[model samples]
Target: MAARQGRFGAQPPRSAAPGRRCVMVTANVDIPALKARHPLVNVIEASGVKLRGRGRVRQGVCPFHEESEGSFTAYGDSQRWYCFGCGLGGDVLDFVQQLEGFTLPEAIARLEGGHRPVPVAAPRPAGTRRPKSAALPPRDPALLTAAARFYA
Candidate 1:
């Protein structure tokens, strides 16, 4: 079984059988694609916080870290953030983590709207009983057969 922390700071449940656990983080997420999904105006309208600036990047106060200056910059192409003062940066997930006080897993889950690569239990081989005939001496065929019949 493999355990990983979820966005809410809880460890995700593991599969029944032990094996390699391949965790995919933003496997299908494209920063550019996500950025294009929502326009800057839409984001600005939806956000309670205000933003200022123009051109390719918008400037705002660092919500995740302490900052008196508007050091947080959001890139229009990537729809990500970078703080020169705190050196904190990343895509939407990182931004959410900082803004909402969410863990990595929690932020990812929120961005994804759910969990991905859902945990699945692997089938285990059933145990079988060996026949007594295989363990018995070859000369004692009758006895082995009788023992096998009795066991069966």
Candidate 2:
């Protein structure tokens, strides 16, 4: 029997089993170009993460989890983000994946198609004020020692 032809003279996928068929899908996308086009700062802002900083470093609340404190940090120079609170970190694609719950290919396609996630307005806890300086607040030695002991 002759195989059926698909669009562009491509042959239809063949069945591996008597009743089951296997299909292969491929995407031709420039990953570096995609990352260049979608920088971490823009992606973070698009996801409703309000960042505050003087230069390349910005801080905001972790969108992945609820917290009254801001533990999410984005480095504009490196085009990456890391949430100290949740320990999640990565580039723009990772950000999209985490924010939209998309797989690797899905995230890539979403970026290629210029489909950004809807911005979620995060509520600020009362009495929280934006710091005047860009520097992160110093960590408490006591807290650090306790954390070290717990982890150890």
Candidate 3:
């Protein structure tokens, strides 16, 4: 089968706005890789929020709102956070974006350090991608049980 050309009788001239070049810009940033590389808990903690509690989850005073008790929980393993007090929950990117009020590109650039450009993750020639551990260790049930009883 042959491709059909448009009303110009052949392929239309590739043109962009008068002064600007028709450059191809891709928005395919490796977000998953970025999130894994930049831990949410570390970022939040670095911002001077005191994370208290134990296990994969930690609670900190909600910076978005005024509260006596801490209601912000940062999940160490997931690199995600949630503010039960205000009901805001999302991934590392979302958290940074919201906190910093930065656009997607700006947030990515900030996370990546404006030194180098971000490259898209190309599809592998081999089989599908395999999930890797985020360096989170397995939880010990016995320890958790002991802690629960102790806290109770």
The candidate that achieves the highest lDDT relative to the unseen native structure: 2
RMSD of 3: 21.8
Q: List TM-scores for all candidates, in order.
A: 0.45, 0.61, 0.55
Misplaced by over 4 Å in model 1 are 1-47, 114-152
Against the correct fold, how does model 1 do in TM-score?
0.45
Candidate 1 clash pair list: 7-105, 7-106
Report the lDDT of model 3 for residue 81: 92
Provide the overall lDDT of each model, using Cα atoms, as 2-decimal numbers.
0.58, 0.77, 0.70
Please give, for residues 49-133, the per-residue lDDT of candidate 2 as tens digits: 7788858899987888767688999998888889999899999889888888876676777777655543455755656754443
Worst 10 residues of 2 by lDDT: 18-27
Q: Model 3 compared with the native: what TM-score?
A: 0.55
Off by over 4 Å in 3: 1-28, 114-152
> By summed lDDT, which 10 consecutive residues of candidate 3 come out lowest?
115-124
lDDT of 3 by residue, 1-152 (tens): 34458886666455666885544322566778878777887667655567897779999876566666779999987777999999998877776677677656667777788532222234334433324425577899999999999999
Question: What would you estimate as the lDDT of candidate 2?
Answer: 0.77
Backbone collision tally, model 2: 0
| CA RMSD (A), model 2 | 13.5
Sorted by TM-score (best first), the order is 2, 3, 1
Give lDDT tens digits, candidate 1, residues 37-118.
5454334324433467776788866545545577877777656667788898876555556656765555556555643212
Reference-based lDDT, residue 148, model 2:
100
